[model samples]
Target: MLSTAARQAHILAKSRVPAANFGLAARRFASSQVQNEASKEDKATAVPSPEDLAKASHLPHISNVEMPNKDINLKNKLEKPDYEKEGYQVPEWKKAFGETFVSLFHIDMDNVRAGTIGGSKYYYMCKDQGLQFTDEELSETAVFWYDTLGLPRTFAMWFQITTLHVWLLFVRMRAMPFKMGKNYQQKLVDKLFKDIEMRLSEEMNVLSGQIRDSYMKDFHSQMLGMIFSLDEAFAQKSDDVLAAAVWRNVFNGDKNIDIVKLEAVVRYIRMQLYVLDSISDRAFGFGDFEFVGPNETVDLLTAEDKAQLLKMTKMKFEPEDGKTLPSQKSKLSLDE
Candidate 1:
């Protein structure tokens, strides 16, 4: 009903109201979005309170600390050389030549006796495994030991193998609870090292007393290194880590090592560890222990054989009504 110009102006006014409202709504939306993003950023950057850190600190068996040189004893009287006085310094060239051609005069009788005792004990322990080695088996073991470790069938090889077996036993002993385990471990270690020292002194018989002392010191260091490395490998729970540890320590870092043989060794170690772990504490404490034969293949172990290996505990016999009865029944059937 209005004039054309008036109608156009009215239409424009109505459109302007919506456009203004839309712009204001957009602005409000953007402002809300900005606020939301800011809140998100604040949350992302939030730090835990001291109370939270304190609570975390109470977690059991969680530690990031490490000890240095705790295993090495510089002040041990056994480690000290009889010839080298405190603050005495020998020329490098003289020390080397002297060690190469020095005369051997006296042997430590005390160390010799201790070593004989320890070596005999270790031999008996291996013998108790009931492994009746045939001539062929003995030859094979000798070859394997020499080829893998670059050592001949000598006293050195004997000691090395003995030490390895002892170390495996030591690993199981570590799982034992309380000071009883610690005491046993200490005694074994002491005997093992004393035997090693005696062997170095008597069998190897280096010319220089200083050189013999040096070799003993070096061997002690190597043992410590092996222990720590094995501990780390076991802790990782990875086959790769364990294999590497075996290659390093047992193979003596030989680059041209046989992969198949190395794998066999790895399997052997794992199987042994599992068997050792399955043994009851009472049985282990009573000196009832055994090792698999060197020629035994873990791959060929049947389920029954595996079960038998796990059952290291001896059967308890009770006399009832003049008849001996077994206290606990074995899960393994005798037919196997």
Candidate 2:
């Protein structure tokens, strides 16, 4: 068998073909309350119980799905937000104060937790099946990883899958303007380590913080290497190079790797990148993008469709007579 480096080199050499051949089309919260003005009012209402208080507030949905084959409603449940954007009803004075503060401080509050929220919610979608499903009821991408590729269902394998998807996002982020791109990358990486640490403790049963930290360091190193390798392949604009990178990093360089499955994965990656390239930087930064289902095909948007999207986005963010809060104001364009 060829050495690992030699194998990678061979794959890259074979990938001298332009990337175009790979079919890279272009394209919350809340509530509470309390009672009373005086003893008469308090006696009349009796300080609403905790249950009553909870019933009064419309809390956001939080997923409780954990085990395999048990998350029958995972897709449907994920469509709801963890925190609602409306219903906060800040006072006009406070809104004005916030607007002043934001202007004075020059804070871009619009994207404040974009990375934290977006990464935690969406990036996990890349390999969520391992956590949500077992071998019995796998998702489309899960089937590709576990059934088609015959990879073991272990945390290591899951990391490989998640990392591959993360790298695909990185490609799109790299195309973004530098400051925004850097912030998104940093926040996403921060969230990744945070989640990994939790998984290592809970799932892997590391028990000891020192040991978990050591494992984290190792994974961090591995991620850096994968990013570098994938970045190089993307720069080369060669599907072959991309395939080689996926083979080495995602498929673990399995000598028995199924070439057909590998090609499908390459196609999947290309398809995702095309969708990412087609989105506006504002839409992505604000956490508006979702990964296309593994089996879904994305038809290129026509000029009319693009125009309609811009119109809808503007209506959502900048309604003509709507009372958009200053905190919600964003300089990002809807048309872009």
Candidate 3:
């Protein structure tokens, strides 16, 4: 029976009779079957809208995916950028900027390694673009390594380097508080941070992990020992003890920092105070006597005190009458 139908179909290859057009008739038959199946499916399923049809047309074509509404794609935007096509570039100036910024904050992230050229460096390159620090940064509260050097890409890097620097300084000052006391140790601390700045200026462009790798060298070990020693002391302290030690002054005061990352956070605040002090010194050229040791004492002068200090330094004295002074001096006791 099958052979008989095949023979009949083969006879239709002559194209003489209406059903003899084998190729054309087969195409018509296939079209009718497709239409019948499509009709059955349409009956079973609801009608698809124009949008759904358009999406289906593009389903397998990954090259041209439509922007699936903002609300749905929010996750993609918040996450990392599409570097494959968008191209994550590390401009020379931006790299230079990171080097300079890290120099100021005391870390040479350029030399640090996050894996590949396009890996960590590229990640940091983008992060450094729109990086933002926490509230502590705006308040100039602590060391502010995040705001200063974290570079949005590697949030941990800035904290790690800055925290290490501060922890070491803290250790040096801690033992000295008993031996040399706060006044002496603090000044030394200031000099230490200053030297860290010099270190940054010297090697701010090194890759990530690069510094940590070479940190076992003689000089690196010395510095690393200082940093480690400070960390160990802090670690030895009870949580409550550590918090109270570094944060007592700033805690529950007119100024308070978010205490999530207590140790590193506290250091961040201190770094900020150091920066503000630098700014003040720059704004007003101080005499050598006014510039004391780093931790010795901040001219934690109030705004009014700062103005008074600046004015006094200018040798601008006013007599009782506020008149012009003589070549030598003006006596406040002079009559109007």
Q: State how far residue 292 of model 2 sits from its true place (Å).
A: 1.0
Candidate 3 regions with alpha-carbon error over 4 angstroms: 1-219, 233-237, 240-336
Which regions of candidate 2 deviate over 4 angstroms? 1-81, 84-107, 127-137
lDDT (tens digit, per residue) of candidate 2 on 1-336: 111221222221211112211111111000001121235543463322212222343322222233323244544443325443335466789778978898788777646745544556556655464443443566665654555455566677677777777776776666566666777677777767887787676555678999998999999998998889887777777778988988898777878766666665665666566556655665666666656544433333457745655555565566588876566766554554
Q: Per-residue CA lDDT of candidate 1, range 229-334, in tens?
A: 7767667666677668778876556687655555655555654564455445444443434554344321222356335433322222122444421212112221
Best by lDDT: 2
**Model number with the top TM-score:** 2
Q: Residues 262-291, candidate 3, lDDT per residue (tens digit)?
A: 443333323222322322211211111111
Worst 10 residues of 2 by lDDT: 24-33
| lDDT for position 306 in model 1 | 36
**Cand. 3 TM to true fold:** 0.18
Candidate models: Cα lDDT each: 0.44, 0.57, 0.30
Each prediction's TM-score versus the true structure: 0.49, 0.66, 0.18
Instruction: Candidate 2: give the clashing pairs.
Output: 28-83, 28-84
| By lDDT: ranked, best first | 2, 1, 3
For every model shown, the clashing-pair count is 0, 2, 26
